[model samples]
Target: MATEYAFDIASDLKTVQALELLSRHISGLTLTWNGKNRDYLVGSTINISVSEQLRSWQETILEGFGFTPTLSVGFRFHNNTDFDAFSEIMFQATMLLLEHAEDAVLLFNYEIIVLQRLGGKLVFNAGYQMWDDDWLKSRLSLPFERRPLPSPLL
Candidate 1:
């Protein structure tokens, strides 16, 4: 069975703008819509959605940071069987969105991973430790390198 991973990004850009950005940058994905749900599908594996609404709590938090996010982008890896592939795609898409967004916050496991303000300042939170952009990028870029296990005792 495949494990599911989900992430949400709060951005100042509207839903249409976010969709356009992703459509332009990421190729080979089919876009579809149903009511307010706009989904970008990668076969039956990945689904990215954009909505004009933000959770009330998210809106309040972004407001506290002086950013009024106009929409929320949700990335769902429904059929993620390989951790490395999932990590790479998530990291790349998150970075691309952050670059163009006026202000954005990335949430995973209900915790804030990275928050960027309009002034180009990024704050990364990983438990008790803090991370810089380059550090986070480097870590995500490689995901996990495969290594051969030690031979069993002979």
Candidate 2:
């Protein structure tokens, strides 16, 4: 069963502020939810991993408050994003959550960045990426090495 953490984060604050408040309640990476769960980005998928780390948190910090908070953290990630990009963020987020699974549920967002050459002295960075399964319109037709550099599927 899910019990309130007793700290209600404000809705009106900017994204960064909400992050700050949330960190106070449960330190580490997390995703913020908008009303009705609409904040979820389009084309995202939820992946969950279970481990002994989660067990330790529930038994130590949460169980004492009459809160038997038992859960694998939940959130979403873009389904079509590149594997390498997702892997990097996933690795980091998972490690963090497992380390503090007792503190709170983690909802984290991952973004990738790519740097490319522009004019002689200028460098351009792309915002998002085209992944393997992306459609006919996808630029993935090119090889990962030959392909234009990719950015995180933010």
Candidate 3:
């Protein structure tokens, strides 16, 4: 059976900066909607939805990106076997936003929602967290070496 899950992130990074970071880091995976290629440039919005159902399992992926000086990236994945993969991707994206806005004291907020059917009824579990620069830095592994450098020699 397919499950519904979503990750919503809010950060101070500009749309262009966020988009650039995602485009660079998440190149390995193709984020398309319904298996169709879509243009997601700076200042542009992206919304993709795809679904597949087979026998005992159904899978769906919905991803959207919006730019408004502050960037919002939402990812919805159904029946995901592992959450680590999702966290890894979000971590990378967050790190990129932080790197771009160095001097700015930024805030980060994220929410995860999972929906499941129980007893023939739909149920959802949702949680959200907000953190400042200090807390985020302390809780997250944002090492200097992991950050992208303009010059490799640096």
Q: Which regions of candidate 2 deviate over 4 angstroms?
A: 1-32, 36-69, 102-154
Q: Clashes in each model (backbone N, CA, C under 3 Å)?
A: 0, 4, 0
Cα deviation of 66, candidate 1, in Å: 4.1
Error of 1 at 130 (Å): 13
Best model number under TM-score: 1
Q: Give the TM-score ranking, best first.
A: 1, 3, 2
Clashing pairs in 2: 30-107, 31-107, 57-102, 112-152
Better of 1 and 3 by lDDT: 1
Give the per-residue lDDT digits (tens) of candidate 2, residues 95-130: 333333322322222123221212111121223242
Give me candidate 3's TM-score against the actual structure.
0.35
Ten-residue stretch with the least lDDT total in model 3: 145-154
TM-score of each: 0.62, 0.27, 0.35
Tell me the lDDT of candidate 3: 0.32
Tell me model 2's lDDT, rounded to 2 decimals. 0.31
The TM-score of candidate 2 is 0.27
The collision pairs in model 1 are none
Q: Put down candidate 1 lDDT per residue, 130-150, tens digits, no spaces.
A: 344565766554232222222
What do the candidate models score in CA lDDT, each in turn? Answer: 0.54, 0.31, 0.32
Better of 2 and 3 by TM-score: 3
